[model samples]
Target: MKAVWLAVGLLVASAASAQDYAESDGAMLRFLDKLTSVTGDVTLSRGQAAQFGRLVVRLDSCRYPVGNPASDASAHLTILDDATQTDLFNGWMLASSPALSALDHPRYDVWVLSCILPEAATEAVEGE
Candidate 1:
């Protein structure tokens, strides 16, 4: 009876972990979608292994209303094979002050990283 209980506990823990992973990955994919839409010249790098590489999106060209604030953004997405690492996908956005070339400089910068979930794990994160 004790052995059975232990096995059941392990199974439950495994399932929970998997679900968490999936949710995290999903979030990253969503972020990527948003970044791609806003930025041009999306570049992807793949490592030797299936789990390596970085997804870089250039957000310098993003434009906003003249009166409104303008900013430059960049996203660095990294994926690992581990389940506990949150499958990090990070983004950095910078806003410049009011200047002739404000777009060239950034006043504020933001960074975000999301975990990797099951759905995103199967998809090709880097390259086309």
Candidate 2:
């Protein structure tokens, strides 16, 4: 009976971890989509606008464990105008607050933005 119960507990824990990872990934993806849309334009300014661009790039390159929380997840974004080799903006996201570990799903929320200069905007941009 003891062994059976132990096995059951482990199984449950494993399942919970998997669920958390999936939820976190989904949330992050959604957030990325939004960020991309916002950065698609070059009207952003130097402060917050630049930060959002960095966030989109960072999130796009993110990779998480199958059953891990995004507590340590961070992102950065950068934009460039193809015509000019100028970097418009850059930003980063770090989990400053205590984020929930995935027991069932991700619980942390992150946002970021960044923008590129008109000169760099002409370059073929790639973010990861």
lDDT of each: 0.29, 0.33
Best by lDDT: 2
Clashes of each: 9, 29
Task: List model 2 lDDT by residue over 9-124, tens digit each.
Answer: 99999998655422122113223234234323222222222222333222222222332232343334343433454543344443332132111112212342222212222232
Looking at model 2, which ten-residue stretch has the lowest summed lDDT?
A: 97-106
TM-scores of all models? 0.22, 0.23
Q: What C-alpha lDDT does candidate 2 achieve relative to the native structure?
A: 0.33
Instruction: Put down candidate 1 lDDT per residue, 95-118, tens digits, no spaces.
Output: 232232221212221232232223
How far residue 53's Cα lies from its native spot in candidate 2, in Å, is 10
Candidate 1: which stretches are off by over 4 Å? Answer: 23-128
Instruction: Let me know the TM-score candidate 1 reaches against the reference structure.
Output: 0.22
